[model samples]
Target: MTGLIMNERDIVVPGEKIASGMDYLPGNGTFREGEDIYSSQLGLVGVNGRFVKVIPLTGKYTPREGDIVVGKVVDVGFGMWNVDIGSAYSAILNMRETSEFIDRGADLSHYYDFNDVVIAQVTKVVRYKDVNLTMKGQGLRKVKGGKIIDVTPSKVPRIIGKQGSMIKMIKEGTGCNIVVGQNGKVWIKGERIEDEVKATEVILKIEQESHTQGLTDTIKNILEGKGK
Candidate 1:
């Protein structure tokens, strides 16, 4: 007989058995050994129709093309800036990709100085060390006067919520301009520091308790209690 050994949203460790028999199929973070399916990573269980997968609880950021990421300029070279996007490899932002006619031999640092934070889109991912980024798109620009926070990259979807409802609610409640990058970096700017702090707290709470049920209601209650 086919059966699920673990319920949906169940926390599972690596190599833990999550299902039994041939009627079930293994998805991401899972492996099939004979008739049993086991978890390949420590994460929350996700059951979608007949597919079972694990939503990782923690992991390093994996840059993908077309991902919007919040990155810091680490080094300014002849024609490009090296950005640390919370990944093992630093992404490159070429001056040509800045969407301006940059004259050759001009100081590239004038456009993007070192230590500057920017919201950029991943233009290309040739390899780990060759990730390319661009700032030509709308809403992609330098971040100023805000606090940045990091979360597990995998938990970004939960923070964004369906149709951007979760983030919209948080912004309404805290009066903060929040930007969430796919690289797990979040920037929050508010009129008051207390509002920013509250937004940060709520975001961290969602990241920690994402696997739990009734998360929407719980977050709403938290915001309401703060008179937000």
Candidate 2:
């Protein structure tokens, strides 16, 4: 008989057992255990049919199409902006994807000066792995008066929780507007600078501890303490 050692979303650290037995199958990050199997490392458990794989919950940013990300305007060209999306591959935001009626000869600097932060959407992913971004729709623009924090891209889903529940709780408790970039950059704005700082600290703490059980409850406790 084979048995699964862990369930989906269960965090396992290095040398942790994942599964056992031969009749039953194993998923990712699993190895045959002389008719049994086990897992290795700190990651979330994901089971697909007879296969079980461990999805690492903490890692660097990986580009994906249609991911809304926060980026800095690094260089402006005749009709495009080079954005640093915290990856080896930089992204391009063409003028056509910007605001309409952009003056043909307007100084791009006036629109997006170097080092300016902006919210953008990944429009296309090239064969070379380069990302194309755009900022021409609602809720996409230069961010002002906020501090940015970096977190593991893989931990974003946990921070957001199911259907935006986790983040909403944080915002309601801290009275801060939090924007999580798919590329792992988080922008937080609050009524006061201290509030913003506290919010960032809370978010970072959540990110660091998301692999643990009862994360939502833990975050709630933190928020409640902050609220008081």
Candidate 3:
């Protein structure tokens, strides 16, 4: 019989034996040497169907279609801006995609210049390895007077939680505007700097302890204590 040695979110190391025997086999992040599967990196175990994979707890961003991302303008063209999305591939924001009625003759920098941080949605994934982004939608625009934090891209969904329950709690507790990017970037802004700091701390804490159960309740207690 095949046996699984780790649970989801369990931290594992390179060359660790994940499973053994021939009735079941491992996939991605594992190499099969005869009847046993060995891990490739130090990461958390993720089981998908019969395949066991490892999600690197620490790594750079990887782009995907329809992922909401936080990015900074790096280069401004006549009708588009080049943004760094923390990926090996750079993203492009076309003039038409930035706004509904962008005048062809208007200066693109007026809308977004170099070093401007903005929240955008990935619209398309190019086959040649480039991503197209758009900013024309609700809650998508330039971010001002806030700090950005970087987290592991794979942990983003956990930080956000199912149906955004985690983020909703953080916003309600701290009264801060928090935007989570699928690319592992976060933007936080609040009326007061102290609130912003609290929000950031809460988010980082979630990122670090996402694997644990009862995270929502733990976070609520932390926020409640802040009121005292």
- TM-score, prediction 3: 0.85
lDDT of each: 0.92, 0.82, 0.86
- Find the 10 residues in a row with the least total lDDT in model 1: 122-131
Better of 1 and 3 by lDDT: 1
Q: Point to the candidate with the largest lDDT.
A: 1
Lowest summed lDDT across 10 adjacent residues in model 2 is found at: 22-31
**Per-residue C-alpha lDDT of model 1 across residues 85-175, encoded as one tens digit per residue:** 9988999999899967899999988888988999999999976668999999999998888899999999999999999999999999899
Regions of model 1 farther than 4 Å from truth: 1-9, 17-38, 46-53, 127-129
What does candidate 3's lDDT look like per residue over 159-195, in tens digits?
A: 8888999899899999998999999999999989999
lDDT of 2 by residue, 1-228 (tens): 457767777878866777776655766566666776666646788887777777766655667888999999999988889999887788999988986668788888888889999999998987626789989777998988788899988788888889999889889888998999988999899999878987888889888887689988888887787678
- Between prediction 2 and prediction 3, the one with superior TM-score is 3
lDDT of model 2, residue 28: 51
Per-residue lDDT of 103 in model 3: 85
TM-score of 2: 0.79
**Against the correct fold, how does model 1 do in TM-score?**
0.84
